[model samples]
Every structure is written in structure tokens, then in C-alpha cells.
Target chain A: MQPDPRPFDEPWQAQAFGLVVHLHERGLFSWTEWAGTLSNVIAAEQSDTPTNAEYYRCWLTALEQILAQKKIATPDLIDITTQAWHRAAHATPHGQPIMLESDPKRIEVK
Target chain B: MHDHPHDHDNNLDPMTARVRALETILTDKGLVDPKAIDAIVDTYETKIGPRNGAKVIAKAWTNPDYADWLAKDATAAIADLGFTGRQGEHMQAVFNTPDQHNVVVCTLCSCYPWSVLGLPPVWYKSPPYRSRVVLEPRAVLAEFGLTLPETTKIRVWDSTAEVRYLVIPMRPEGTENMDESALVDLVTRDAMIGTGLPQVAS
Candidate 1:
């Protein structure tokens, strides 16, 4: 069907999509290997397919898996940063970009 | 169409931050370019679409030999037509006939032929569509406002990481004299997805 030209539902979706593509170009993993890892993660969903948001969430999960597999970063490392971003996002006022330095936890670490 | 406005990062969410975190981590490690991420996003978001696939569909309708090639080996045929090096490297052309209508769904993930169709529609990636398209294609298609006859057998092709299928909707009758470019206008993105039929040539 002729769907409206909406490539992504959200900006993060685009970032997630691009992040994988750029990573592949950097030689972290081949496209085939990336596809294989993504397929496996989606296969785990089995009969229950993901919603668009959840689908990209799967993308993020696969990215983490790929990075971890390559020993570039571990789940714990990503989780820490992800949580930090979450805190920063909450701390930031409306209409402001959520910079990582805005995270309250960073102050504790310092 | 969603309530979530993606234009501004200020109205934040968990997934948004999560991806940002990844980008930040990768950037810190000297493995990523923040600007490149924006560029890739812009290209996929605004530049790519199903027009490429529509061109292929139109060509197949106008050229019998091209149709044969598409039927035999879609990847090479489509690549020869100048659509390659995108999301799906392995692909197949699933033609819809008078008796048998073909529909595609990626029950595993969103395994679309991005080289041809660009990104899959949001509906195509939804849980309901991915599940119901297999168990009851007729019912699922009906939801998309495409109600094929009970006599017309509906075949649901499950896309895998290895091969993604593109549905070539049968050409509308009474367009034999139309040029390839004229025929292109009739082919809709949804037709290629098997969720919608092409517009009839006037």
C-alpha cells in the first residue's frame, strides 16, 4: 500500500537505525553478521512480534549484543550510560537537550 | 500521527535516552561521528521511500522479459534495474495472480526489502500485523481495507534475514498502450507490500 512517507515514528528510531548502519561501515561487524544477530533477537520473540517502538528497542538490544560480542562494550557499561542519560533527561527542563553532564550521578562520581 | 513529537529531544523518553547513550558511548570511544548519525537519519527519514520499488513494478508490468527475470532471480534483476546495496541483499519477487494473491510479513522482525521498498511502514512492523497475517491473512488484509475474494487464495510469505519478498500486484487491465512512466504512477507502495492494490489507470 502507499503509506505516507514517515521513515521513523521518532527521532531516536532514526538514530538507532543510523547507529547500526554507521557501525557496520566502521567494520565492527559485517552487515550479514549484524543481520544474523538482529534476526536471532527477533526470533526470540517467536509468535509475538514487536510493535514499532519495541522493534527499535530490539534494535538497541541487538546493538548492545553486537558491541558486547566484539568486546567493545559490555551490557553493564551501556546500562550505566543509558541510566545516566535517563537521569539527565529527567533533570533537563522542557525544550532543552538532555546532555550527559546534566546527569546528577555524574556529580556523585566526581 | 503519534502524539509523541520527535522534532524536539526535550520531550524525552526512555528509548530516546537509551539510543543517545549508545551514540555517546560509541562517540567517546572514537568509533562514531555525531554528525554522521544525523546525516544517516536524515537520509533514511526524508530521502528514501517506495518510489524505487514502484519503478520496478512499473517496469515489470510493461516488460514481459523483465518480469521473467524478476520471477527467476529477483535480486539480480532488481539490481540490474539499479536497486542494490541497501537493507536486503537477498530478495524475491512474489507476484499476485488472479487466483493466488501474495502478501508479505516479517514475523521474525522487520525484514523488508529496503533496497526496493525503503523502510517498512509502521503498521507492517506492528505485533498484530506480524501475528495475524500468518494465522488469517484474509482477515488481516481485510483490516488493511483489502478484501480479496475467498476464491482468490492468499499466500503469506514470511520474510527472513536471508530473503525478503516484494509483492508485484498484477497489472490493472486496459493499460497496454500506456508507457512505463505512465504505469509507474499506478503502482503504490502498499501494493508492493500486498496490503493495498495499485490505483487503476485513468
Candidate 2:
């Protein structure tokens, strides 16, 4: 079967893509290290067979796991940040860039 | 075209939320500097993207030998101008002629020549474009507001592997007297993607 050649549907995917490359370039992790870690995570999650979107989800998961393992971040911190973004995004009006609100409650609807 | 997996949820996609969260976490922890990331992103978005490609196209317009070089070995020709890296390591330049029109799409993934084109636009990666362009090139081009002549045969190049394709749009007519800099100004990123044409002086 041929692989799907779809572009990222959202800006975040591109951002994630950039982040991964940037991190690797900065020597945070070697490509071989990333490949091994990512493949293992994908294998464990049965993401061995994943759609284009799911593939990036696997990339994120591996990234998170590696960062946590390396003590670069705590899983709890990531979760907290993720929920905050969700809330901010939900409160923001349509057709606006989803700017992160330092205090989620302070975001004006307008 | 396949319907994207998450359309009904009008909220920012979960991935976006997660990435933002990650950014925040990384920044707070001092593991990654947001400013540095922004600099890299800014460079690609502004300094490096299609402007680089425009210079190549413009040079090709003025220099026949250079055009021949690009046609024969895009990687080498582009590298000659210092536009070679990453997604563009393996490159191919396709030319458009009166009888032939070229458009590029990567049906499986968004593998663009970032060294030359920077980031792929959101629409390029959307399901409709990824799956439909190869099958219905005319319709997709039409939707982009590019109405080509019926006699112009459309050739859709599916960038299925390592070799990325860049469209060398035909130089607009009546620009015969224009210099390379003016011609470079006329070449927009969309034109290089074949969704738009070079600026026609009015």
C-alpha cells in the first residue's frame, strides 16, 4: 500500500513539525534516538497502522515521553497547559487567532 | 475526497490546543526558548520561502543556460544559488508551456520544498486538495481562481517520494522588457505552486 501524502490540516501540525526538527537540530535528541523512541511508542500504541493525523499524534506522544524522561518537563505541567489552551480556545470568538490568555478568565469575548 | 476526521468539533482542533500547551510548558520549564523557535519560524515564513524560489525562477527567465541547468539538475542548479537544504535535498523543477501546465501535490503527506517554498499552506494539506488534485486537477485549479485555457493540458505531479517538485510557471506575456528584479517581484508563492499566475502588469 502507498503512503498518504497529505499536508497538515492545521497550523499546529506545522508548528509541531517545526518543533521536532528544531529540537533535533539543537541536539536535544539524536535522530536515531528519536526514531527509536518514536517507533517504540508507535509500536506500543498499535499506531503502527495510523492515518496521517494519527502519525503526528504519535510524534507528539513520543516527544512528550522523551521530554519527561529527560526531565525537561513534567507530564503534569503538559496536561495543565493543554487544558488551559482548550479553555482559552473555547472562550475565544470565531475567526480570531487563538492567543493564549495568561489568565483564561481575563479573555474578552470580543 | 475523504472527509477530514474532525470537522464537527468547531473548537480549535485538539492538536492545536496540545501544541500550545506544550509550548507553554516548555517555555515555563526553560527547556525550550519560545523566542528562538519564533526566530526559526520567522526566517522560514519571511526570509527564506518563495522569495528564494522567485530568484531562481527570475534567473531562469533571463538566463537560458541557467534554465537548462535547472531543467537538467534542479538540486545542483538551486544549490548553485545557495537554496539547498532539508526538504529540498532532492529537487525537480517542472516548467509550464503554452501546451502544458504543471501542478504539484503530495497526496500522502505534506512534503514541500521548505528550503524554497517554506511551509505548506493549510489548504495544501487539507483532505480535499491532497486526495483530489491528482484526480481532478482542473477543478482544484479552478477553485484557486486560476482558470487556464481548455487547450492547456494539465499535468499533475504526485510527489510520492524523496524528489520534491517546484513549478516554474511560464513568464507572463508582455513582460518581455521587464528586468530580473521586476520579474522576481511578480513571482508569488502561489504561482510557484501553480495555483496562481505571475503578476501581469496592467
Candidate 3:
């Protein structure tokens, strides 16, 4: 039998899926390489949080590790962005779209 | 002066944190163009939605032959409308009748068909939903503002990474004259997921 069709339950899950494909297309990492890293992450989680319901969490962790290992993003930069999303999500309305708000205190290199 | 509307929930925001982190890094190094990312997200966000599934459901409603085709071969019938890929490689359509009500859940993981119904909502992926829905489907449906009669049988279809289920809600009453397009307008994401019923003109 074929795999069940509906697999993702959240918008973020789809976005994360797309992001992985986009990164791969940009030559960041091969799916084969990703498979190994993801397996390790999943295996680690199984040992740690065996009942973890967050499957996408594993995917995100693997992606982060690959980016850091490739020197594409530093840990500090990632932290800043993560914090920014928290702030943005915090500020946005319940039904409104979650968008990153430009931090006036920080300068954009662009 | 006040732009803050959403409460800052400091507890357990790891998913948002991880995704934002990746987006930042990819955009910073020029490895990913933000516009491209937005375009992809937009396709799922705006261009695609429950309307696709609604159209399918509406077709099934209007045409008995199409409904049979959907029941016998959902993946192909869905693909007939060009909605196929990724998480949507396979599909199972569960019809809702007066005697039985069907709800979909993924206890192991959130497996949803993106090609037809687009992305799943946050609540659908919540741990409470993943665990509770299977244990007490009627209760879960109640929480979603869906109350079923005591005599009605509730069946919960557990979706896996291999196959996803789309709940074909019983068409609402008072819309017998509505065309497929109008019917599409009544089909909502929640209804497709079996969390809620299709819209009924009051």
C-alpha cells in the first residue's frame, strides 16, 4: 500500500519541508547526507525523548547542524534570528501573520 | 502606539526558534533567496488551500460516479485534478454518513496531504491532539465545536507518513441548489480534517 497522503499538520511543517528542499537546491547539502544526519538526530531523540511527538523538531535540528557544520551559519547568528522570531510572534495578533519585525537597535548588513 | 496583540508565550517555542534560525542563516549567507522562500510559502498559504480539497469534495458530491472513483482510488482521483506530490503521494477518502462520522488523526506524527488541503494547522499537530484524539474522538470533536449524536458512530483514521486521509463531510442541508463553486465556498479546512462541519447557511 502507498503511504498515507496527509503527513503534515502545521504550516511550519510545510515551510520546513520547503526550506530543506530550497537549501538542497542551493547546494547546501545532499539528501543522502541529510538522511544520515537526520537519522542520527532521530536516533538521538529516540534515546532521549522516545515519546517525542515533534517529528519536525528532529528535521529542524538536523538542518541546523548541517548549516553550522557547513559554516553557512554561525550559532550566534542562528540564536539572534530565533530570538527575533520569538519577539515577532509575541507581538503579532493571534490571527495575524507572524512576520519578523525589524529590530531598530540592530543594524541590517543588507 | 500599541502593536502588541499576541501574548508572548515564553514556554516551549522551539519550533519557531529552529525555523527562524535556519531562515536567518540561509538568507545571510546568500545560500537561499528570501523571495524564493516567500514564493513557495505563498503558494501553500494563498494560492493553495482547502479550496482544492473542497473542489474535490464538491465534485464527489455532485457526481456519484466521481464519488465512487474517489472512494475506490483517491490518489488517482485527486491526481486527476493535478494535486499530487510530497506528502500527498497517497490518499484515502472516508465518507461521512448520518450513521458514522469520521475524524482523522496522526498519533505517531502529523501526516497531512499538502497538495490538496495545503498545510495543517497548529492545533492539529499539538501533542494533545495527537494523543487525545485517538483515545476520545467524540470528546476531541466536541472540543472543536463539533457535537455528534450519541447514536452516531465515530471512526478515527490514523494517518501515517505513507497514506493520508481526507474526511468527506456530509454535505450540509439547504444547499441542494448550490453549484460546485458555491459548494466549494462552504467546504472548509476543518471540515476536510473532520474537526468541524462544512458551512451551513443559517
Candidate 4:
């Protein structure tokens, strides 16, 4: 069926966007850091001329950088977790919600 | 994106299993709340966003200045219409001309212009549509019931994780008297997706 047309949105983008707000609310990073990093990315991206995607992609990048810098979720940790999630997704059934329980790399509980 | 234990066979964010998977990881790590993300996406998607693409196309068809602006800078033009949001989705407008036809596909996953095109149809996220559209664009377009002449150059654009594309279809003939609002009605989601054409002036 024809899904009605709307502005182009990816669930991940919204999740990323919301994640920033939530993290900020939780005091994971200062608003100054978020703004500065995002501004730097936008400024760097302006050379290519900012479009919509590049505009917000900075959010994902800035978030990652900030998280990494703060050692909250380092780049290596994010990478490892991303792979773990992939494994979990494969382990989970098609129709079931993927859970960390299904992560094959998860340590056995006591 | 139902999280229930019910017997529903569908997955939440089926088109983007990878991102959904990442979201699960993030949730598990206390990086985000599932319900909040859902609310944000739902609010943005449902908020008067459905018509922005058609309006842009319609305006482009009716106004040369706006069309030129869209060609020069799609993001600014799109933002000028008050369509900008904090979310990622840098757009590049691709126009179908008499000589060059553009079609968009996401070879890796269903990276559609979801905000403008809405949620992707099942066929769009299907393996055949995703894999075949890039390899054999002409045949794929024909299967969508769009037949172009041999001379029209068909360019297949792949929407990557970093960027998305919008297809601005050629205004149909006999639409000279149609206003922007009237033209908007003629713009179909498929037309913007490059899978079909705008409704012929009728």
C-alpha cells in the first residue's frame, strides 16, 4: 500500500535526536559541549554545503565523540556493542523483540 | 514498533533491522528510552509533514525561482518551507528531465525519504526492489509500470545511511493552468520516489 508521503525520517535519526536530549537532561554532557561539537561538525560540513542529512548526521557524530571523550561509551565499546547487537538480532526470532538476553556473547548469569 | 508479547508476526522497524538492533543496544545501556524515541518519531512523522514534499514539487513546477533555488540548494529551500527538524536527513533534489530519469533505491537497507515519502511500502523494502533496482533500473522501472523510451537516460540513485534523495518528477503536459495546490494533488508518493510518474493532467 502507498504509505502517505511525509518528511523523510529514519527511526534511527529520531532515536539519535532524542538520545541527545535525554542524555543532556541526564547530565551526561554539558549543553556547551553538545553545541560546540555540533557547531564544529556543521562548520566542517558547510564546505560541502549543508543539506538536511549532513545537518543532523553531525548529531550522531557529535554524540559519539562526546560519549567517547567522556568515556561513557567509548568508540571501541560502541563498536563491540554494535556487533553484539547484530548477533542478538540474528539469534532472536523474526517476530520477537530482540533482547540483550539473546546476545550470544552475554556472560552466563550466576 | 510494537513491543508486546502478542502473536503479531511483524517486527518493530522491520525496514531498518540494523538501527532497531542498535536502538535495542542503546536502550539496554540506558542511553535512551524506547517510548520517548517512539513518541519523538511519531510526533514528527504525524505532524503536518506529509504534504511538504508535494508542496515543494508543486511549487517548483509553478515557480521558476523556487525551482532554481531547489536545484541550487535543496536543504535551504526545503527549510525555507519550514520543514527543517533537528533529525538527520540531508536531502538532495533529483529532477527527472526529458532526457535523464532518476530513480532512488537503498541497496543496503530501506533508506527512503521517509519523512517526505512516508513509511516505505513493503515492496520498497523487499529484496527484489532493493537489489534489483540498482542493477537493472530500466527493467525495474518497467515493472513499476513506468515505461520510458530507450533514449531517456535512467540514473539509479542509491540512498545511503548518510543521505537521502527526493525525485522531482517532470510536470505533466496540459498542467499549464493548474495552480500550485492543484499540482500538489497530482504529485504521488511513487512519483517522488521515482517508481511512478505524477498523475497526468486530468
> How well does candidate 3 score on lDDT at residue B147?
97
lDDT for every model?
Answer: 0.83, 0.75, 0.74, 0.70
Which residues of candidate 2, in runs, are more than 4 Å off? A1-17, A26-110, B1-36
Per-model TM-score versus the true fold: 0.82, 0.64, 0.65, 0.58
Model 3 interface CAPRI class? incorrect
**Tens-digit lDDT track of model 4 for A70-92:** 77666676666666666676777
lDDT of 1 at A5: 82
Predictions ranked by DockQ, top down?
A: 1, 3, 2, 4
Q: Candidate 1: where is the Cα deviation over 4 Å? A: A1-3, A30-51, A83-110, B1-12
Candidate 4 runs further than 4 Å off: A1-110, B1-30, B33-35, B48-50, B85-87
Candidate number of the best TM-score = 1
In Å, residue A77's CA in model 2 sits off its true spot by 8.0
* Interface DockQ of each model: 0.48, 0.18, 0.19, 0.12
* TM-score of model number 4, chain B: 0.80
Per-residue C-alpha lDDT of model 2 across residues B41-142, encoded as one tens digit per residue: 656645666778888999999999999999999999999998876432488999999999999886655557777777676567555686788888999999
What is the DockQ (computed on Cα atoms) for candidate 4? 0.12
For candidate 1, write residues B78-181 as lDDT tens digits: 99978885544688999999999999998756778887777887778776788888999998888889999889999999887678899999998888888999
Best by lDDT: 1
